[model samples]
Target: MQYFLVSNDPDRRARWHDRLKAAGLNVTGEYDPSAVIVTIGGDGTILYAARNYLEPRILPVRAGSSKGNRAAFDVDQLVETLQALEDGHAESSSRTFSTLTAEADGKELEGGFQALNEISLHHSSPVLAATFAARIEDDTTWEFPELIGDGVLVATPFGSTGYFTAITGETFTDGFGVAFNNIHTPADTPEMVLCSESVVVEVELLSTKRSSGAVLTRDDDDTPYELSEGETITIRAGDRTVELLDVI
Candidate 1:
């Protein structure tokens, strides 16, 4: 089987490269058709791989912490895992996770970026809080004229355990989740659970106490898109899903 390996650390990359070669697996430098992408790192590595590659089944090896919620296997089990895969014993141990897409105004973001975790919007300046208006379309339409907070986010079920739970103190097995950041009005914290059908969320930055703008970001992205005061951002469930190898 053809495979592509990715790792941020040089040592881990070299180690996996050698191991996969020693196991007689064909490892390629570039993503090719019918290739299984193997990532050796934490959850961030998995997110990075998903952002850069499409339609490849991913096998995430836990090269970092043992407590990683998204990791499927540890480093010590790499060889055995690959062996099982080679023997066709691990084909059934896979799960599909959905992604989220975001658009600014009417223009879609490049690559139609998908986030496996959550899509977040926050104040651009550190010292000030940004005010926003949010509208949700699920089974019905719900609108909040004024939601004053640091930011807001929309998360998928696969992401519910991450930043979503940290902000809302709630977890979901399915459907999408929405939560407000540090709202100035402590009593006005808004949270919602919507079905898998595309959720249309429109957010407008009304004002900022001291900052000039707000920014939008997705899971693990280093760069952020600036948000103007009256500009609107539309977020919805992505069309594609990520496949993760569930090692047994």
Candidate 2:
């Protein structure tokens, strides 16, 4: 089977390359959509692969001191695990995870604004909290007229274990999770919701503070979309899903 090894460390990749070659596995120099991605790092490595290669099956291998939530095997076990798959002695199951898509003022962002984790809209300023109105349109509608806070986020089940957990101190099994970030006003505070994946979240920038506006962040992307006042942003589950190759 065709496979690719991904790593940020060049030395590690070189060593892994030698190991794989010794074990009789060829590493593709170029990314092949059909090839299984073998990432040699932590959760960040896996997430990076997940975002860049949407359709490839990922084999996350933990290495060094990296903490990987989705790593399937350690570095020492990688060769053996992969051999098992090749010999049909073991199998890899696909675990599908949902993704996020966002739009600004009804127009989809560039490159479709797809994310594997959560989408956030927050105050761009450092000291002041932004005011925004959030509405969850689903089976049962819920709305907060004016939320004065750092910002808000919409997270998928896979994302619930990340920032959503840090903010709400909870993780959910299914559906999208919503968290209110550092709300200044106690009144009209909206509780965190773990609603269906079909739910649509709308955030209206209402902050009137000087130079105040919201920045929309997708996953851990460094570049975020600017959300001006009076503009609305929508977050929803994307149709595309990520498949991880789980060794079993």
Candidate 3:
């Protein structure tokens, strides 16, 4: 079967390349539309693969000591996993994860960002907190105005164990989760559970200092979009989904 190998580490990449080649697997360094993308690293590598190759099935094999939350198999299991995949015995191990889409000012900022983790908005300046107002699309009566905090996040069920848990100390096996970060009101539990419904949040920079703003980031992306005061960002479930091979 056609396959694409994705890895940041040179040694791990070479090792897998040699092994897969010896096993008679057609592996390519470049992404191919019909190829199964195999990631030979941690969860970060998986996210990178997803960003570059959106539609391919991903099989993430942990390479280093850090067995991240999303890693399904370790490097030691590579041979067996590949054998199973080649034999079509790994079909039962497949799991699908839904994506998220974000829009700003009625323009689509992200068409469909597949985040196995979460999407977040935070204050640009560390010293200044951002002000926000939120409302659920399904419930018009529910509104949170003037939420002064560092930021907010929308996490999928698969992402519950990551940043969502870090902020709220809770996780959910299903449904999306919303959590507030460093809110001014310490007494209030800054978490909410929502069904698969869209959420709209408007952000306002509390600080008037120059270059003060908010940022929108998805997963572990290094770059973030800057948000002007009073800008509205809409988050909802995406149409596209990602299929992950369960190697554990």
Candidate 4:
């Protein structure tokens, strides 16, 4: 089968190139427009590739790790996995998918990508609160919404094991597509709904200039937006879903 490898290791890259060639399969270092993507690094590489290629080709080989992110599978095992696929000894199953779109103030992010993990928004000051607004994808109850808290975030079941676990104090199976909300901080004052499955959310600066904050980060987007007194951020699962070449 046609495959593409994305890695920075000169020696390993060369080694794989030679090995794959001898195996009678075509491989390339650059993103092959018509080939399956094979990320050769750790989880960071997987996440990077996931965003770069989206669904389809963006799969991983677990070369190594960076910042505790893992490809879910390891390299040594990956060697066997790739070989199995090449030998037609194994196949992949299906996995659920979700999309995260980030809009700050009132505009959508023009760059970066939707997060596979959780979407987090924080108010810059500890002494102040930022009002997070939201709209459920197709909910008719609340046309415009708000969540008063120090900050707010939406996490999926796949992401339930990551940042979501850090806040909600709970863990869930990856097979479930859901969201978590945490509003127990001091700045949130009393409290807000700890969790909800609403598909849409809008975040904004509620208080006056009493606090200064900028940017709403999704996955890892660095693009920043200035918040007016009523500026808001809206987040909803996108129409597209990522498909993983399930191996386990």
- Every candidate's lDDT: 0.80, 0.84, 0.73, 0.57
Each candidate's root-mean-square deviation in Å?
A: 2.0, 1.8, 2.6, 4.4
In the range 1-248, model 1's lDDT, one tens digit per residue, is 78788888878788788888888888887778578888888888888888878755888888866356777778888878778877988753777888888886566776575788998888888777778888888887888888776788899877788898998788887778888888876465555555554678888878755536788889979888787778888998787788987776
Model 1: colliding residue pairs: none
* Residue-wise C-alpha lDDT for candidate 2, range 1-248, written one tens digit per residue: 98898987879988998888889986786899888899999877877787787665888899999876878889999899888988999988887788889987666787678877799988888787888899999899998888888889999877788889999999987889889988877655765877998999999988668765678988878888888778888898886788888889
lDDT of model 1 at position 25: 84
Please list the residue runs of candidate 3 whose C-alpha ends up more than 4 Å from where it truly belongs after superposition.
Answer: 87-92, 110-114, 139-141, 185-189, 197-210
Clash number for model 2?
Answer: 0
- Worst ten in a row by lDDT for model 3: 200-209
Clashing pairs in 2: none
Q: Rank candidates, TM-score, best first.
A: 2, 1, 3, 4
Ranking by lDDT: 2, 1, 3, 4
Question: Which one wins on TM-score?
Answer: 2
Candidate 3 to truth, TM: 0.87
Clashing pairs in 4: 43-70, 133-202, 134-201, 134-202, 202-233, 203-233
Counted clashes in each candidate structure: 0, 0, 0, 6
Worst 10 residues of 4 by lDDT: 186-195
Model 1 TM-score is 0.91
* Residue 62 accuracy (lDDT) in model 3: 80
